[model samples]
Target: MEQHYQLLRKHIEEICVLTDEEWDVVAQRFTYKSLKKHQFLIQKDQLVPCEYWIIKGLTKAYAIDSNGKEHILQFAMEQYWTSDFNAFQNKVPATIIIDCIEDSEFFCLKWEDREYLCHEIPKLNHFFRIKSHYGYIALQQRILSLLTETAEERYNNLIKKMPKLIQRVPKKLLAAYLGVTRETLSRF
Candidate 1:
Protein backbone atom coordinates (compact mmCIF):
# COMPACT_ATOMS: atom_id res chain seq x y z
CA MET A 1 0.00 0.00 0.00
CA GLU A 2 2.78 2.38 0.89
CA GLN A 3 4.65 1.34 -2.22
CA HIS A 4 1.59 2.11 -4.35
CA TYR A 5 1.47 5.65 -3.00
CA GLN A 6 5.17 6.00 -3.61
CA LEU A 7 4.69 4.84 -7.18
CA LEU A 8 1.94 7.41 -7.71
CA ARG A 9 4.19 10.09 -6.27
CA LYS A 10 6.97 9.08 -8.62
CA HIS A 11 4.63 9.05 -11.60
CA ILE A 12 3.49 12.59 -10.74
CA GLU A 13 7.04 13.82 -10.26
CA GLU A 14 7.89 12.76 -13.81
CA ILE A 15 5.74 15.68 -14.93
CA CYS A 16 6.01 18.17 -12.02
CA VAL A 17 7.64 18.34 -8.61
CA LEU A 18 5.56 18.00 -5.48
CA THR A 19 6.49 18.95 -1.93
CA ASP A 20 6.03 16.40 0.86
CA GLU A 21 3.08 18.31 2.26
CA GLU A 22 1.44 18.52 -1.16
CA TRP A 23 2.11 14.85 -1.73
CA ASP A 24 0.49 14.03 1.58
CA VAL A 25 -2.66 15.88 0.63
CA VAL A 26 -2.77 14.23 -2.79
CA ALA A 27 -2.14 10.75 -1.35
CA GLN A 28 -4.79 11.04 1.30
CA ARG A 29 -7.51 11.76 -1.24
CA PHE A 30 -6.94 8.62 -3.28
CA THR A 31 -8.66 5.45 -2.01
CA TYR A 32 -7.19 2.05 -2.76
CA LYS A 33 -9.16 -0.64 -4.59
CA SER A 34 -8.46 -4.16 -5.73
CA LEU A 35 -10.23 -6.37 -8.24
CA LYS A 36 -9.94 -10.02 -9.15
CA LYS A 37 -9.44 -11.25 -12.70
CA HIS A 38 -12.45 -10.62 -14.97
CA GLN A 39 -14.15 -8.33 -12.43
CA PHE A 40 -15.95 -5.28 -13.71
CA LEU A 41 -14.54 -1.86 -12.83
CA ILE A 42 -17.09 0.19 -14.75
CA GLN A 43 -20.28 -1.28 -16.18
CA LYS A 44 -22.23 0.39 -18.92
CA ASP A 45 -25.15 2.51 -17.77
CA GLN A 46 -23.73 2.80 -14.26
CA LEU A 47 -22.46 6.01 -12.75
CA VAL A 48 -18.68 6.31 -12.88
CA PRO A 49 -17.47 7.91 -9.65
CA CYS A 50 -13.72 7.93 -10.03
CA GLU A 51 -10.74 7.71 -12.35
CA TYR A 52 -8.33 4.90 -11.50
CA TRP A 53 -4.57 4.90 -11.47
CA ILE A 54 -3.19 1.43 -11.97
CA ILE A 55 -0.85 0.30 -9.22
CA LYS A 56 -0.50 -3.21 -10.61
CA GLY A 57 -2.21 -5.34 -13.27
CA LEU A 58 -4.11 -4.81 -16.52
CA THR A 59 -7.61 -3.81 -17.58
CA LYS A 60 -9.59 -3.13 -20.75
CA ALA A 61 -11.96 -0.33 -21.50
CA TYR A 62 -14.58 -1.43 -24.05
CA ALA A 63 -18.10 -1.34 -25.28
CA ILE A 64 -20.46 -4.08 -26.42
CA ASP A 65 -22.45 -3.44 -29.50
CA SER A 66 -26.11 -4.36 -30.04
CA ASN A 67 -24.87 -7.47 -31.77
CA GLY A 68 -22.89 -8.30 -28.62
CA LYS A 69 -19.51 -7.84 -30.21
CA GLU A 70 -16.89 -6.14 -28.10
CA HIS A 71 -15.00 -3.08 -29.27
CA ILE A 72 -11.97 -2.40 -27.17
CA LEU A 73 -11.01 1.24 -26.77
CA GLN A 74 -7.76 0.72 -24.91
CA PHE A 75 -5.87 -1.29 -22.32
CA ALA A 76 -4.50 0.08 -19.05
CA MET A 77 -1.57 -1.35 -17.13
CA GLU A 78 0.82 -0.29 -14.41
CA GLN A 79 1.19 3.52 -14.12
CA TYR A 80 -1.71 4.14 -16.50
CA TRP A 81 -4.69 6.27 -15.63
CA THR A 82 -8.09 5.13 -16.91
CA SER A 83 -11.77 5.81 -16.61
CA ASP A 84 -14.85 6.40 -18.70
CA PHE A 85 -13.72 9.97 -19.10
CA ASN A 86 -16.90 11.19 -20.75
CA ALA A 87 -19.06 9.85 -17.97
CA PHE A 88 -16.69 10.79 -15.18
CA GLN A 89 -16.28 14.37 -16.34
CA ASN A 90 -19.90 14.93 -17.28
CA LYS A 91 -21.40 13.15 -14.27
CA VAL A 92 -23.36 10.89 -16.58
CA PRO A 93 -23.82 7.14 -16.73
CA ALA A 94 -20.96 5.30 -18.37
CA THR A 95 -21.31 4.18 -21.97
CA ILE A 96 -18.37 1.83 -21.88
CA ILE A 97 -17.21 -0.91 -19.50
CA ILE A 98 -13.87 -1.45 -17.82
CA ASP A 99 -12.86 -4.89 -16.60
CA CYS A 100 -9.79 -6.37 -15.06
CA ILE A 101 -7.77 -8.62 -17.30
CA GLU A 102 -5.75 -9.77 -14.31
CA ASP A 103 -5.96 -9.36 -10.56
CA SER A 104 -5.49 -5.60 -10.25
CA GLU A 105 -4.91 -2.86 -7.71
CA PHE A 106 -5.66 0.82 -8.23
CA PHE A 107 -5.75 4.16 -6.47
CA CYS A 108 -9.11 5.79 -7.08
CA LEU A 109 -9.62 9.55 -7.13
CA LYS A 110 -13.12 10.91 -7.11
CA TRP A 111 -13.96 13.97 -9.22
CA GLU A 112 -14.37 16.32 -6.26
CA ASP A 113 -11.20 15.12 -4.60
CA ARG A 114 -9.27 15.59 -7.83
CA GLU A 115 -10.65 19.09 -8.18
CA TYR A 116 -9.67 19.90 -4.61
CA LEU A 117 -6.16 18.53 -5.10
CA CYS A 118 -5.66 20.55 -8.28
CA HIS A 119 -6.89 23.68 -6.54
CA GLU A 120 -4.72 23.13 -3.49
CA ILE A 121 -1.61 22.14 -5.41
CA PRO A 122 -0.73 24.14 -8.50
CA LYS A 123 1.90 21.62 -9.59
CA LEU A 124 -0.76 18.88 -9.49
CA ASN A 125 -2.90 20.94 -11.86
CA HIS A 126 0.02 21.19 -14.25
CA PHE A 127 0.73 17.47 -13.91
CA PHE A 128 -2.86 16.55 -14.77
CA ARG A 129 -2.98 18.99 -17.66
CA ILE A 130 0.17 17.54 -19.16
CA LYS A 131 -1.16 14.03 -18.72
CA SER A 132 -4.39 15.03 -20.43
CA HIS A 133 -2.49 16.46 -23.36
CA TYR A 134 -0.57 13.24 -23.77
CA GLY A 135 -3.76 11.24 -23.62
CA TYR A 136 -5.28 13.41 -26.31
CA ILE A 137 -2.26 13.04 -28.53
CA ALA A 138 -2.32 9.27 -28.11
CA LEU A 139 -6.00 9.22 -29.00
CA GLN A 140 -5.35 11.27 -32.11
CA GLN A 141 -2.56 8.98 -33.20
CA ARG A 142 -4.75 5.94 -32.70
CA ILE A 143 -7.47 7.50 -34.82
CA LEU A 144 -5.05 8.36 -37.58
CA SER A 145 -3.58 4.86 -37.55
CA LEU A 146 -6.98 3.23 -37.76
CA LEU A 147 -8.00 5.44 -40.65
CA THR A 148 -4.77 5.41 -42.63
CA GLU A 149 -2.81 2.30 -41.77
CA THR A 150 -3.32 -1.31 -42.71
CA ALA A 151 -3.85 -3.86 -39.96
CA GLU A 152 -0.34 -5.19 -40.39
CA GLU A 153 1.11 -1.68 -40.23
CA ARG A 154 -0.88 -0.91 -37.10
CA TYR A 155 0.29 -4.17 -35.51
CA ASN A 156 3.89 -3.30 -36.25
CA ASN A 157 3.42 0.19 -34.83
CA LEU A 158 1.84 -1.18 -31.67
CA ILE A 159 4.66 -3.67 -31.23
CA LYS A 160 7.19 -0.88 -31.55
CA LYS A 161 5.29 1.45 -29.24
CA MET A 162 4.37 -1.05 -26.51
CA PRO A 163 5.92 -4.44 -26.94
CA LYS A 164 5.20 -5.22 -23.29
CA LEU A 165 1.51 -4.62 -23.88
CA ILE A 166 1.55 -7.04 -26.80
CA GLN A 167 2.95 -9.69 -24.47
CA ARG A 168 0.54 -8.97 -21.60
CA VAL A 169 -2.75 -8.72 -23.50
CA PRO A 170 -4.42 -11.71 -25.08
CA LYS A 171 -4.32 -12.04 -28.87
CA LYS A 172 -8.11 -12.00 -29.12
CA LEU A 173 -8.36 -8.67 -27.28
CA LEU A 174 -5.52 -7.31 -29.39
CA ALA A 175 -7.45 -8.27 -32.51
CA ALA A 176 -10.51 -6.48 -31.19
CA TYR A 177 -8.48 -3.36 -30.48
CA LEU A 178 -6.92 -3.46 -33.92
CA GLY A 179 -10.27 -3.96 -35.63
CA VAL A 180 -9.18 -7.24 -37.11
CA THR A 181 -10.29 -10.84 -36.75
CA ARG A 182 -8.25 -13.12 -34.50
CA GLU A 183 -7.23 -15.18 -37.49
CA THR A 184 -6.03 -12.04 -39.25
CA LEU A 185 -4.08 -10.87 -36.23
CA SER A 186 -2.30 -14.21 -36.10
CA ARG A 187 -0.82 -13.52 -39.52
CA PHE A 188 0.88 -10.35 -38.27
Candidate 2:
Protein backbone atom coordinates (compact mmCIF):
# COMPACT_ATOMS: atom_id res chain seq x y z
CA MET A 1 0.00 0.00 0.00
CA GLU A 2 2.82 2.38 0.77
CA GLN A 3 4.42 1.65 -2.58
CA HIS A 4 1.15 2.36 -4.35
CA TYR A 5 0.85 5.55 -2.37
CA GLN A 6 4.33 6.52 -3.53
CA LEU A 7 3.29 5.80 -7.10
CA LEU A 8 0.34 8.12 -6.68
CA ARG A 9 2.62 10.69 -5.17
CA LYS A 10 4.96 10.39 -8.13
CA HIS A 11 2.11 10.83 -10.56
CA ILE A 12 0.95 13.89 -8.67
CA GLU A 13 4.46 15.26 -8.72
CA GLU A 14 4.41 15.07 -12.51
CA ILE A 15 1.33 17.31 -12.51
CA CYS A 16 2.85 19.67 -9.95
CA VAL A 17 5.42 19.50 -7.21
CA LEU A 18 3.83 18.50 -3.92
CA THR A 19 5.40 18.79 -0.51
CA ASP A 20 5.96 15.51 1.32
CA GLU A 21 3.23 16.34 3.81
CA GLU A 22 0.83 17.37 1.08
CA TRP A 23 1.49 14.12 -0.78
CA ASP A 24 0.71 12.19 2.38
CA VAL A 25 -2.60 13.94 2.75
CA VAL A 26 -3.49 13.28 -0.87
CA ALA A 27 -2.49 9.62 -0.70
CA GLN A 28 -4.38 8.90 2.49
CA ARG A 29 -7.78 9.31 0.84
CA PHE A 30 -7.27 6.69 -1.86
CA THR A 31 -8.10 2.98 -1.59
CA TYR A 32 -7.00 0.29 -3.97
CA LYS A 33 -9.13 -2.30 -5.72
CA SER A 34 -8.55 -5.08 -8.23
CA LEU A 35 -11.05 -5.75 -10.97
CA LYS A 36 -11.35 -8.67 -13.35
CA LYS A 37 -11.79 -8.40 -17.08
CA HIS A 38 -15.33 -7.64 -18.27
CA GLN A 39 -16.19 -6.29 -14.81
CA PHE A 40 -18.16 -3.11 -14.59
CA LEU A 41 -16.37 -0.42 -12.64
CA ILE A 42 -19.40 1.76 -13.21
CA GLN A 43 -22.72 1.00 -14.89
CA LYS A 44 -24.59 3.31 -17.21
CA ASP A 45 -27.24 5.55 -15.64
CA GLN A 46 -26.08 4.55 -12.16
CA LEU A 47 -24.90 6.98 -9.54
CA VAL A 48 -21.08 6.83 -9.47
CA PRO A 49 -19.55 8.62 -6.54
CA CYS A 50 -15.95 7.67 -7.17
CA GLU A 51 -13.23 8.34 -9.76
CA TYR A 52 -10.32 6.03 -10.45
CA TRP A 53 -6.65 6.10 -11.32
CA ILE A 54 -5.48 3.08 -13.25
CA ILE A 55 -2.40 1.63 -11.66
CA LYS A 56 -2.34 -1.15 -14.23
CA GLY A 57 -4.52 -2.56 -17.00
CA LEU A 58 -7.08 -1.04 -19.31
CA THR A 59 -10.57 0.37 -18.90
CA LYS A 60 -13.01 1.81 -21.38
CA ALA A 61 -15.86 4.26 -21.03
CA TYR A 62 -18.68 3.43 -23.42
CA ALA A 63 -22.40 3.63 -24.02
CA ILE A 64 -24.90 1.44 -25.76
CA ASP A 65 -27.10 3.06 -28.36
CA SER A 66 -30.80 2.42 -29.00
CA ASN A 67 -29.82 -0.10 -31.65
CA GLY A 68 -27.57 -1.80 -29.05
CA LYS A 69 -24.40 -0.71 -30.75
CA GLU A 70 -21.51 0.04 -28.44
CA HIS A 71 -19.89 3.44 -28.80
CA ILE A 72 -16.61 3.82 -26.95
CA LEU A 73 -15.95 7.31 -25.68
CA GLN A 74 -12.52 6.84 -24.19
CA PHE A 75 -9.94 4.35 -22.95
CA ALA A 76 -7.79 4.64 -19.86
CA MET A 77 -4.64 2.61 -19.46
CA GLU A 78 -1.81 2.67 -16.94
CA GLN A 79 -1.12 5.93 -15.14
CA TYR A 80 -4.39 7.40 -16.39
CA TRP A 81 -7.40 8.75 -14.52
CA THR A 82 -10.97 8.03 -15.52
CA SER A 83 -14.54 8.67 -14.39
CA ASP A 84 -17.97 9.62 -15.61
CA PHE A 85 -17.45 13.39 -15.75
CA ASN A 86 -21.17 14.13 -15.62
CA ALA A 87 -21.62 12.05 -12.48
CA PHE A 88 -18.37 13.21 -10.83
CA GLN A 89 -18.80 16.92 -11.53
CA ASN A 90 -22.56 17.46 -11.49
CA LYS A 91 -23.60 14.82 -8.90
CA VAL A 92 -25.86 13.30 -11.49
CA PRO A 93 -26.36 9.71 -12.62
CA ALA A 94 -23.89 8.45 -15.24
CA THR A 95 -24.67 7.92 -18.89
CA ILE A 96 -21.33 6.20 -19.52
CA ILE A 97 -20.18 2.85 -18.19
CA ILE A 98 -16.57 2.13 -17.23
CA ASP A 99 -15.58 -1.48 -17.83
CA CYS A 100 -12.33 -3.28 -17.32
CA ILE A 101 -10.97 -4.78 -20.50
CA GLU A 102 -8.23 -6.56 -18.61
CA ASP A 103 -7.63 -7.60 -15.01
CA SER A 104 -6.78 -4.32 -13.36
CA GLU A 105 -5.61 -2.53 -10.26
CA PHE A 106 -6.82 0.98 -9.53
CA PHE A 107 -6.80 3.57 -6.79
CA CYS A 108 -10.10 5.29 -6.25
CA LEU A 109 -11.21 8.43 -4.41
CA LYS A 110 -14.81 9.08 -3.53
CA TRP A 111 -16.51 12.36 -4.41
CA GLU A 112 -16.38 13.61 -0.84
CA ASP A 113 -12.72 12.75 -0.54
CA ARG A 114 -12.02 14.46 -3.84
CA GLU A 115 -13.78 17.59 -2.63
CA TYR A 116 -11.78 17.52 0.58
CA LEU A 117 -8.54 17.22 -1.38
CA CYS A 118 -9.48 20.10 -3.66
CA HIS A 119 -10.42 22.29 -0.73
CA GLU A 120 -7.31 21.41 1.20
CA ILE A 121 -4.89 21.44 -1.71
CA PRO A 122 -5.44 24.10 -4.30
CA LYS A 123 -2.64 22.74 -6.50
CA LEU A 124 -4.40 19.41 -6.73
CA ASN A 125 -7.49 21.17 -7.98
CA HIS A 126 -5.44 23.01 -10.55
CA PHE A 127 -3.86 19.75 -11.68
CA PHE A 128 -7.24 18.09 -12.18
CA ARG A 129 -8.66 21.17 -13.87
CA ILE A 130 -5.79 21.09 -16.33
CA LYS A 131 -6.60 17.48 -17.09
CA SER A 132 -10.25 18.37 -17.57
CA HIS A 133 -9.37 21.23 -19.87
CA TYR A 134 -7.16 19.01 -22.01
CA GLY A 135 -9.86 16.37 -22.25
CA TYR A 136 -12.44 18.93 -23.33
CA ILE A 137 -10.09 20.33 -25.91
CA ALA A 138 -9.43 16.88 -27.36
CA LEU A 139 -13.15 16.17 -27.50
CA GLN A 140 -13.76 19.39 -29.37
CA GLN A 141 -11.01 18.53 -31.85
CA ARG A 142 -12.46 15.05 -32.41
CA ILE A 143 -15.91 16.53 -33.07
CA LEU A 144 -14.59 19.03 -35.58
CA SER A 145 -12.49 16.42 -37.32
CA LEU A 146 -15.44 14.07 -37.59
CA LEU A 147 -17.66 16.79 -39.01
CA THR A 148 -15.21 18.05 -41.60
CA GLU A 149 -12.54 15.43 -42.27
CA THR A 150 -12.75 12.48 -44.62
CA ALA A 151 -12.80 8.96 -43.15
CA GLU A 152 -9.39 8.12 -44.57
CA GLU A 153 -7.95 11.32 -43.15
CA ARG A 154 -9.43 10.55 -39.75
CA TYR A 155 -7.96 7.05 -39.85
CA ASN A 156 -4.52 8.38 -40.74
CA ASN A 157 -4.69 11.01 -38.02
CA LEU A 158 -5.73 8.42 -35.46
CA ILE A 159 -2.88 6.14 -36.48
CA LYS A 160 -0.44 9.00 -36.10
CA LYS A 161 -1.88 10.41 -32.92
CA MET A 162 -2.75 7.24 -30.98
CA PRO A 163 -0.58 4.54 -32.38
CA LYS A 164 -0.63 2.55 -29.16
CA LEU A 165 -4.41 2.52 -29.24
CA ILE A 166 -4.41 1.14 -32.77
CA GLN A 167 -2.16 -1.68 -31.58
CA ARG A 168 -3.95 -2.44 -28.27
CA VAL A 169 -7.61 -1.67 -28.79
CA PRO A 170 -9.78 -3.91 -30.93
CA LYS A 171 -10.04 -2.71 -34.50
CA LYS A 172 -13.85 -2.77 -34.44
CA LEU A 173 -14.00 -0.43 -31.45
CA LEU A 174 -11.33 1.84 -32.97
CA ALA A 175 -13.39 1.97 -36.15
CA ALA A 176 -16.47 2.91 -34.20
CA TYR A 177 -14.61 5.69 -32.45
CA LEU A 178 -13.40 6.95 -35.81
CA GLY A 179 -16.97 6.83 -37.18
CA VAL A 180 -15.95 4.36 -39.84
CA THR A 181 -17.19 0.84 -40.41
CA ARG A 182 -14.89 -1.97 -39.41
CA GLU A 183 -14.67 -2.96 -43.03
CA THR A 184 -13.62 0.55 -43.90
CA LEU A 185 -10.97 0.58 -41.21
CA SER A 186 -9.56 -2.72 -42.47
CA ARG A 187 -8.96 -1.17 -45.84
CA PHE A 188 -7.12 1.79 -44.36
Model 2: per-residue lDDT, tens digit, 1-56? 77777788888787899988888798889999999999999998889888899998
lDDT of 1: 0.94
Per-model TM against the reference: 0.98, 0.92
- The lDDT values for all models are 0.94, 0.87
lDDT of 1 by residue, 30-148 (tens): 99999999999999999999999999999999999999999898899999999999999999999989999999999999999999998999778898899889888988999999999
Give stretches of model 1 more than 4 Å off. none
TM-score of decoy 2: 0.92
Give me the candidate number with maximum TM-score.
1
Q: Candidate 1: worst 10 consecutive residues by lDDT?
A: 119-128
TM-score, structure 1 vs. true: 0.98
